[model samples]
Target: MDLDQSVIGLTSNEYVFEVERRHVGQFAAAIGDDHPLYTDEEYANQSAYAGLIVPPTFPIAMNDGKTEMPLALDQRRMLHGEQEFLYYKPIRIGDRLRCQIKVSDLYDKEGKSGKMQFLKLDTEMKDETGELVCISRMNIVYRSLAN
Candidate 1:
């Protein structure tokens, strides 16, 4: 796939996800986090948040095949470069979230592994009330086979 010409500025369809208590607990446990804010309902209710909260990386589970770039890049040749999340508010249980994903940037450069294409994607997540909750930035590198 010619990512530079095909993916940059591509905006994907919006996806909606429901945040359930079980999902929060499962994600926390999978990441080896036993924080009471995420695992214990009673403890969370007593805290400032007033309810169970999802972990910082809980957005990973929100990828339900609704937001996808049209690059058609090969998965085997793609490498995850970096990922960052900016949180404006905590993701609480029972909150329905919506995400709008976009391919913000795409470029090619030469690196130790030779020619590489960098694809930057951004996903904006909002709560059911339409309040911004978080933004996730993901960078992926596609190595050139001809290099």
Candidate 2:
């Protein structure tokens, strides 16, 4: 299966998410991270951040299915190729974030099983002040459609 090359450079609509305490606590609990910054508000307030802060990986949940490819995708044949994140500032509770995803690259390659399609997505997030907070790059691999 071949991916639509035209989708490269396309960007999805901006998504706005307001960080909340519950969101932070739930994600921390779900990931089994009991760090003070993620769970203890008082401890975090005494630290440099001055309040509750989310775990580094918490942005994964901020998209809320809003980050989508312009073309259709088959979940059964899709695989997580890789994920990379760069954080500029700590995400704290009550911070409003503006986010968007862009299709950075797409290509096909020959695999042992067959041909595979690769889609690279870059998600950029900024704070209410318009300062960049984090950038996440995810690569999705699609196996050839079954006969």
**Which number leads on TM-score?**
2
Q: Give per-residue CA lDDT, model 1, range 1-147, as digits (tens).
A: 455556677787888988887877778888899888887889999998887778888886777765566446688878888998888988888878898888888888988877778888888899878999988888888787764
Model 2 agreement with the true structure over 1-147: per-residue lDDT tens digits: 467788898888888988888878888888899999877778998998887778888888887675565567778888998998888888888888999888889998989988888988888899988999998988999888778
What's the TM-score of each model vs. the native? 0.84, 0.85
Task: Please give the distance, in angstroms, between residue 106's alpha carbon in candidate 1 and its true position after superposition.
Answer: 1.6
Per lDDT, the best of the predicted structures is 2
Per-model C-alpha lDDT, please? 0.81, 0.85
Question: What's model 2's TM-score?
Answer: 0.85
lDDT of 1: 0.81
Backbone clashes for every candidate come to 0, 0
lDDT, candidate 2, at 88 = 88
> What residue runs in model 2 are displaced by over 4 Å at the alpha carbon?
41-51, 65-68
Regions more than 4 Å wrong, model 1:
41-51
